[model samples]
Target: MTTTPRSPAYPSSPLPSASPPSPAPSSSALSSASPARWPLLDRIEGPADLRALPHHGLGQLAAEIRDFLVTKVCATGGHLGVNLGVVELTLALHRVFDSPRDVLLFDTGHQTYVHKLLTGRQTGFDRLRRAGGLSGYPARTESAHDWIESSHASTALSYADGLAKALGLRGETGRRVVAVIGDGALTGGLAWEGLNNLAASAHAGPVIIVLNDNGRSYAPTVGGLARHLDRLRGHGPDAGVADPAPTAGTLFEHLGLTYLGPVDGHDTRAVEAALRHARSLNGPVLVHCVTAKGKGYAPAEADEADRMHGIGILDPVTGRPPAAARGKESWTSVFAAEITALAARHPDLVAVTAAMLRPVGLHRLAEAFPGRVFDCGIAEQHALCSAAGLAMAGLHPVVCLYATFLNRAFDQLLMDVALHRLPVTLVLDRAGVTGPDGASHHGMWDTALLSAVPGIRLAAPRDPATLRELLREAVEYADGPTALRFPKATAGPGIRALGAMDGIDVLRRSPHRPLDVLLVSAGVMATPCLEAAAALERDGHGVTVVDPRWTHPVPDALPGLVARHRLAVTVEDALADGGIGSALRTACAERHITTPVRALGLPLTFITHGERPELLARAGLDAQGITRTVTQSLTPRSTP
Candidate 1:
């Protein structure tokens, strides 16, 4: 959950560097002046200022913003390619709609940097996703203009529908509700559900559904839906265009909604016009706009590195950087390497993703064995069941999905996969307090939800190397369904950090005194546990902190470990119900080692959007929070 600001090939020592105003080209100069080279974009403060500029200058502004985004994202690590791809669409939406009043909902808010920049957040772009800085995704709390604080993919259409219905019920008028969704998001079942309902609407309310089709989700999309999209994209919107007519038009029409476009998304004028036309329509309408992912940047455009999905900061002029320095490899990177190696050995080994080949680091496997790797568009449920069927066919299928999004496929994972005890290796990425992207995208529930599966063996790796070993182990374990959960942030220094994973590291030594208190922490929060131990040690409280890498299966050594201690504390980043803490309490109760056990985790509530550390701190997960809670628990209860 913590990231050190270490950049590769950065100015070593104090080398002379130019204080250059970002290398990206800015909007045209405003006549002759002292700062004649200054860009007009820097002068514009907000949307009103942007509106003041002529339409001719908007393209220049988008270019300036793209340059600014590239420069800033390079410095502060966050989502890069998705934002760059949607510059024109973001700019056009703001220019057309009166946002904050006219609800503009961003699907999978990862692509909202330009939306943020236009809505008076340009000044803060340099510090995006950094702790206490701007969030990487759209957060309603951040600004009044941001209507929906969403980070999870494929849910905005539902929000848009509900809001539209609410507006109608309240007799609210004049406001146009627009949902900017991607081709990737369309793969989710919720989007279809919203589309089905919205398509069935009787009231002719003005709702604009912008399909920002970039043809890639996390990685190059897969499955029938993606192929259907290819037909639509290839055949343009011409009446004579063939290929049995695309699904968007007929599919929505059958469901009773209007369908428009296959418009050129890169051209702001065209997109703006299409939006205006959709706004003029009575009921729900879909405006399909096609744009290049990583639009203007040549390297991003030319490179096939995960569909130019995103990469680390590069020199603006050359778009070149030295080979990504091998620090401790991330769990995702390790998964990619290991999965590729595994697939090479076992012909039956195949990989599947819900349109997240790149973000989950499955791009290498996807590239190596194109036939073996399946990018199942944005449909998480379909991806799960498809993997189940593959497993049934004697092929080992690994479904690599983000933890937050995989919640949509719980029923499928339970009924279709777990019911049959299918051997599907689910690699759940972003399984904790995913920094910056906010609450919706955070993978905070997989442990609790998947833990209940009858045959599922849930495993979480503390570091990258363990992740590789665990992934290989899970794939080969053909008896039942298995899952490995990990967070979104760069993987910490691997097995070396844990010292030993031979049945949980007993970090704090309280050998002399009878072990009175034991703290069992899971996943990435172990770092804070170590800090909390130091804090508790200073207060003369003996603490034994254990990182139980395998929280479920309730490690065999745990009973003896718990028996040795008088009080036990179980902490996890997940919710309390059915989580590590809950499991620990159950285990203690079953083993008859009462010892006054306490569970510490996220409160039973739907947490809102904010900086990751701030959210965690507010939720009593920080070192200070842990220290206070542990101290309070040690206090004797009043009889009254």
Candidate 2:
């Protein structure tokens, strides 16, 4: 449990021997749930407690822990499939290496649920990914055991390399560095950049890279790299077969890292022994631990789509909610339906996804036109640039991604996509304050960031109908780049337009009386803007709410509309700084329109995970909060 590596491990540092290799757990231990509850799991405080158990007892402990996770995640609704997949591998890791001091970094930290549970965070699971509770990913603030806090994939290898070098430089060479990376993550360019560097520095102390090949990142990992991993697993390089000491033969060996394993990731004893061997190697090494994406439970195994990668509250026994689901189409579903329809009319339309087909709702598009969809693995940068290629090749490519993930490809978006003025349409799902999964996962910065990109037509759809219409319009615009951002929740009922101006849709009009407030709503903010308008009317303020449909370039129609009202307020879910309202004010000044415009939005701070509406209200992006802010801003200033 004490993975805190000892002091001064020189080049030929000796690997610590914990105990003899434990016997593999019997099928009964894995197949059938333990009759007794998590007695061993409850007793265990941390990794040390779990590690101290005898070899045979480890199986019972793992079973207890797995059962505990199933029960806990069923109620709490967290990353169920991933945690279940890594149970035995996690046990092996705790057995092989000490944590905290050893610098055990996890790529795409969602897989660290088992790691967290083992590292004395079992108690934090009740409110997992909830407000003021345990984060969905590894959090350094939560525990000393955690180091890197990035939830994004494919950067752990780089951290491992840097940490290894720093350890050597600071004479903390005794501390070992191990990066537990997924095969899916290995597809990212950043991982390869680190690999290229780490391979070149074979002589710079030992750093063990544990390749946890789960064969997935939201979906089955695609491309040439996955096939290479398959060949490595088949050849049994990880089973202590092809020693990298003399032979520079295997792919990893050529990369200057010793190879070990096709180790059974499900077999705790085998993985422990293989890791121990890897730890003892003279130079940098890779321990390939092939694990199933959803290993233990039948429901997770049977469910092919992402193996229920992440899910809502579910019945423990059936993996289903008690009642039938009810709601209008979600934003993702709407995009899926609309985009698929767009593809039917436009044969030249193609869909591109960065390893997330189902999550971003690209499957519908893929189904409509099978080969037209291209999954570019976990490489968002490549996804964007390649989408530019598709656009340049006389085809309209919709680059579908989560709003948060799109942040990874900003450079590509600006340089490759925008500089070339490609007609690629970026479809960003889960825009605005994503409810849970914590700060790192929120899609808060897209609006501010995208606004800076020149010639990019950004469309924020407020409802299902708008999304349908906007997508059709975006695909048809071949002059330059376009993006359509939508929220995660179900789309609300459409608000019919009261009237139309230059290009804006007036959703609510207070024409009977003189308008004191001009409420400019961008995309999904239309709902709250109308609510705020009603609230303002009750307080003797006649508010006119308009949906610009497109918020970028500071629409010419907007400044003119704002001139009619005394106080112009632009509301958006994006960050207040450098957001839509700021853009409007700047645009109005350029056009010589003197109306005072105020930006109302979420503050430029890390908003915590909570219910979407609750977070919105807390951030003053909700109706009551907006009304309160506008009322306060409109109040006459006291003479100083």
Candidate 3:
């Protein structure tokens, strides 16, 4: 979505005569030429330092902060566009309200980088989104100013509601709770729930909801609410009319909130005035601030697709990643190509995404078959139930989402799709230990959660070929709900199957030596499992590796295969507890198989941010780690 820049009617009067605002900080003010690029930004150690700046100087400081953000975030990689958009808004918020005590909560915390910088965490940007460095989203441990830590969308308002209630009960009536929710976040059902509760509980202190309308989520905000917001903003300064008073008949006003201006989010003075007015209300208020997602920066502003919402390390000036990092075929690309091809072949096939049309690879399908793709806006639960409806009709629905986000729609998937035994295929991208984005962003929990679904068939692809094959299989399976999950990493070369036993694809076999070990590889775990098998063979043990393309339901031949081997180990890029390994173990037990079954996967814990390989190795799911585990299992141990 292209954001139309608005020319706010800033005050035309000259600076005051007494206590005139200081001029923008010059480079000469720095102690040294080096490490002093952002002289104005360098001065800000906290919100107090920012608040101390004069009004005129704040504009220059905002520019410096944007420059600082681009320089630091481009090198480290982060939510650059959103943060860039909120520079002045964040400044205005900190200036008008005292944080830590006032309680400023940001929905979809990726937009909190500016807030982080103003809160004395500028130095941490050097290692932004890295292991043992700064987290991508707000972390409660990072600073007292950061109250909540969630990257998930549509959660901040609910947090604000609860915080407001707690503050009221504690008799801390002076402390205000502000929730800065985006138009994208507002589309979710939970956000409406919070709005409903906040409106109903008129006694639960004042809550200033700053609607940061950047006109986009991963794409442009969709549905009825977006149109309503557009209507509210249509009659503003951009329309060449006088700055109107708080308009009535707004969605917020209808919900019992005092509706403030569709104020220019970039205009510090206007936003500050609006926030102050909101703070004075002593009840629920909404200050709708219209912003350009990639304000100021030429490259980001010009970007049509997502406006660089999230990015890898890139050249700040060019706003382009290095050649090596560019055009690399990822699992998402594979799915995009396959899905587009599939859509063309099947006229009855349709796709659905939860405000992540582009991120989850449905953009290809949407482009190819325009009317067939549905953009459900940050509402995953609604997406699934709607998909269930689509299935109940005649069309086959492929519901695509990030594996982490799939957690939000579990109940819908179970009751609506699986219970009805509808033909729905869930394409779960980033389905395993996704790196850098941290614990909340990781897709490691999907396999465990999906395993609990009664009639859901889950498939984990080992490579691009298998991904394409399995996706077609999943879409064609009209028996029940089916899901195809893959990681965020590049889809490497396909692993050629040595043979097939029932439905399992055997990748490796030890012919000469006796059947000693069976290696069960799930999805992309085949590569590492093969390495482990080769290592075991060198250590004088017969090892066989297999991939159950569809991992759920426990392949019929699996228990029989396990019975032939002395030990059976299932390796997956998912939780060890309820993952494919757990399913296989149960299957073997049911068949009275005597072979010892070992589940080799991620531990039941919140995995921190790091490189995918490093995290996998640390969890003993890598080739070296898998080999070590097998070797240890083969070795004799003395009694303690």
Q: Candidate 2 — what's its lDDT?
A: 0.82
TM-score of each: 0.82, 0.91, 0.93
Q: Write the per-residue lDDT of candidate 3 for residues 1-640, one digit (tens) a residue.
A: 1111222222313212212221322333322236767778889998888889888688778877777777778788889889889988999899999988899999999999999989999889888888888999999889999898879999988998999999999999999999999999999999999998987785688999999998899899999888787777783333334335444256676667777777878778778887887898788888889988878777888998899999888877788998889777899999999999988888879999999998888887887789999999999999999999999998899999999999999999999999999999999988889988989989999989999999889999898899999989888889999999999888888789988989899999998898888999999999999998888899889999999899998889889999998888899999999998888888888888878888999888998888889999999999898888777776443579
The positional error of residue 375 in candidate 1, measured at the CA in angstroms, is 1.6
- For this target, which candidate reaches the highest TM-score against the unseen true structure? 3
Q: Arrange candidates by lDDT, descending.
A: 3, 2, 1
Taken over the whole model, the C-alpha lDDT of each candidate is: 0.74, 0.82, 0.86
Predicted candidate 2 versus true structure: per-residue lDDT over 40-93, tens digit per residue: 777777778877877777777766666777777878787888878788888888
| lDDT tens digits by residue: candidate 1, 1-640 | 1111211111212322212212233222212124323286676666777767777777677767777776677566567778778887777788888777889999988888888888878768666766566877776668997777677778888888888888887788688899999888888888888887777665535677898888777666555566766766664344346435333244445566566667767667666776776777655778777877777665566666653454555555445554574364666787788888988888899988877777788879878898998877778888999998999999889998888887889999999999998899888887877656666667888888888888888887766766777788888899989988887666776434434546676656554554656888787777777788778878777788887777786787776677777677777787867787777777778888767777777877766545567778877888888888788877554579
| Order of models, best TM-score first | 3, 2, 1
Q: Give the best candidate by lDDT.
A: 3
Candidate 1 lDDT: 0.74
